[model samples]
Structures are given as C-alpha cells and as structure tokens.
Target: MPSHRAAGLVAGLLWLASLWLPAISLAARHADMDLQAFEQNGWWLLTAGWVGIFSGQPAWLANLLVIGLVPTLLMGKQPPWWVSLACAALSLLSLALPGTTIHFDGGPYRVVAFDIGYWLWLLAAQIPALLMLTELNVRRRAK
Candidate 1:
C-alpha cells in the first residue's frame, strides 16, 4: 500500500510537471513549434502516466489533470477511458512520432498531445477504479 501510494503521488507530480513543456508550447500563441517542442514534451506524458500508475494519486486529481491536458489535442474530447487508452497508446507510438516535430502536425500532434495529455488524465482518473480492483483481488486471495 505504501508503494502504491508513492506511485500515485509520482504520477500526479508528473502531470503537474508536464503542463509546462511541449503541451504548453503548443498552447501558447507564439510557440516555437520546433523539434525541441516535441522532444521533452513527448517524454513528459510517458513519465506522468508511469508515475501516476505507481504513485496512486487520487482519482479526482487524475480527472483534473486530464482536463488540463485536453487542450493540447485541439480535437473533440471523449470519455475518460478513451483518453487513458490513448496515453498508453502514445507510449508505444513514440516510435512513430519521433523527435523534432511541432505539436500540431496532425497525426504527430494528436498522437502526442492527446495521447499523453488525455491518457495521463485518464490514468489518474481511474485510480479509484484500480483501487477497487486491487481491493477485490486482495479479498479473493483472503477467501
């Protein structure tokens, strides 16, 4: 449980840290939109998701983080689960997105911003559900 708690905190911290990098650059009116924009920002999402999963931030915090991340997509939103899945997908998609790109180059941007932002958002959001699952697993073991 202590480990779980630490993971949640790390995830939440990642999200908090993520706001300032590529996503923010994309959001600003006069962003550089250079390769560097995507580089660290791309990594930020992955880090946040991993940290969130490990830290066990509260579900409400995840929901809020998702909201903060959605604007980076500049696309229509979906259910939280969709966002969460997208993040996991992005972690894999980095091979495709690669380094040195703007945050709005259609596929690259959506895959990056939406995946990282929405996904991390979704991850934090689902912590409660995971807790329930963990609890059930524990109960089954006891039985």
Candidate 2:
C-alpha cells in the first residue's frame, strides 16, 4: 500500500479507538447544581450529539464531520488533497466548544477541558491531510 493509504488506515483506527475514551469534562456554572463535573466519552458524543444541534450547539457538527475522513481515506484509490484538508478544517470546529454553554438536564454547563479522546479525534482528522500534503510536496520535488 502507498504511504498515504497506510496513514489513512492508521488515522481511521485511531478515530475508532478514541470513541471509547473520554473526550471532554464539563462543569456546572452554579455551585448548587445537582450535577458537578461530568466527563463525556467520544462514543456518547458521536451517537447522541445531534440533539446539540437542536439545542443551538453547532460545535457538535464538527464531531460529526470527522466521519467524512474515514470514507475519503478508505473508499477510493486516492481522494483529492483538498478533501482531506477540508475534513481537517471541519474537525477543528470542535475548538469552538470550550467557551460555549450547553444545556444539559435542565442546567447550563461549560466545557472545562478537552481529554485524550478529543485530541486523538483531531489527530485522526488531520492525518490524511498531512500525508496528502507531504505526498504532493514529494511529487512536486520529483518534477
């Protein structure tokens, strides 16, 4: 297999593994809130996050977009480099999640920290783009 395809496989595996890891820690703004700090795993977010969109939290869309990377990398002989780059850009939208308030269980919560899963997910989204860029650079140099 080509290096880029190998890299894409690795990325896809990383993303799948990250699904079982904790992605974020959320804290209630009020001291008296029934729930305190809550850790949400990637699987939970990926499976149930569509509700966030209805609740006006579009950042979850970024998480959803990362799925695009899997097929783009695995389905074809080679996808355009720009497609991978676009996936990378969309994956970064999760960065906007930190300061945004989310309504959960009738309470407002803020994301206080990103965990390993989040970083891994971001990395997975980026790997294809990075590899494609390097491949393009190598091709240019061969000219």
Candidate 3:
C-alpha cells in the first residue's frame, strides 16, 4: 500500500493531467454562425490564462495553472493550506464563469454548453484542497 504522502502525490499528478485536456468547446447553433465555433476552444492549464477567448483574460484570475499544475510539478511536497484553499476557491469560481457564452461578429451571441473537460477540470483542481484537509484531519486525530 502507498503511504498517505505517496497517494496524495499520485492524486496531484492525475489532477494536473486533467488540466492539459480540452477545457471547453464552442459550437454554433445556426448556419449564420461561424463553423469554427464547434472546434475545441480552450487552453490547457499551462496556457489557459493567455490563450482562449474571454474578457480581460479571466482565466488568469481563476485557473488550475497556478494551483494544480504548478504544485504538482513539485513532486510529493505537500502544499500549504493557503495554497490548497486558494486553488480550491479559484477552481470553484471558474465553474461559475460564463464560459458558455460565445460572441459573434456583428451577429447574435452563441452560447455553447460546457463539455466534459470543464467538469473534469473543476474536480481535478479541488484534489489538493481535499488532500490537505484529509491530512490535517489525520494529524489532529494523531495528536
């Protein structure tokens, strides 16, 4: 069996992998819309902040890149509580973002539904925080 730290590290790595997959897809509802709209439209966690179509780079403010991707690169090092909390909070907030809304050129707006990527991103981003809480709980009981 793996130690708690090892398990956490594995979980963190898996979480990071999810960030690289497509985070969203844009689709056009009518023929008047651009056909490219259906293409996978999103950046992985690494470039999620700079790439993609959003107002003022909203992803930078709430992205797994900062929390999930970065920390996972550190290997098995346990992240501080603040880091976990921030990651969890930001990931959750991203879910609330209007990612489905797609703007058109001199046409009506098209809203695309979130694909599996969005849901996976949300779940993966929260792993660190959940692991942190579990660790804290275990430590408390051991005391």
| lDDT comparing candidate 3 with the true structure | 0.55
Give the per-residue lDDT of model 2 (tens digit) for 32-123.
Answer: 64668888998987877677777665555555445665665665456666667777876776787887676768778888899999898889
- Lowest-lDDT window of 10 residues in candidate 1? 21-30
**Candidate 3 lDDT, 47-97, residue by residue in tens:** 534443355434445453444444453565666678777766766755544
**lDDT of candidate 1 over 88-113, digit per residue (tens):** 44333333332223334343332234
The ten-residue window of minimal lDDT in model 3 covers 44-53
After the best TM-score superposition of candidate 3, give how far the Cα of residue 103 lies from its true spot, in angstroms. 4.6
Estimate candidate 2's alpha-carbon lDDT, on a 0 to 1 scale: 0.75
Best by TM-score: 2
lDDT of each: 0.41, 0.75, 0.55
Task: Evaluate model 2: give its TM-score.
Answer: 0.82
Model 2 segments beyond 4 Å from truth?
A: 31-35, 51-68
Worst window of 10 by summed lDDT in candidate 2: 57-66
Q: What order do candidates take by TM-score, descending? A: 2, 3, 1
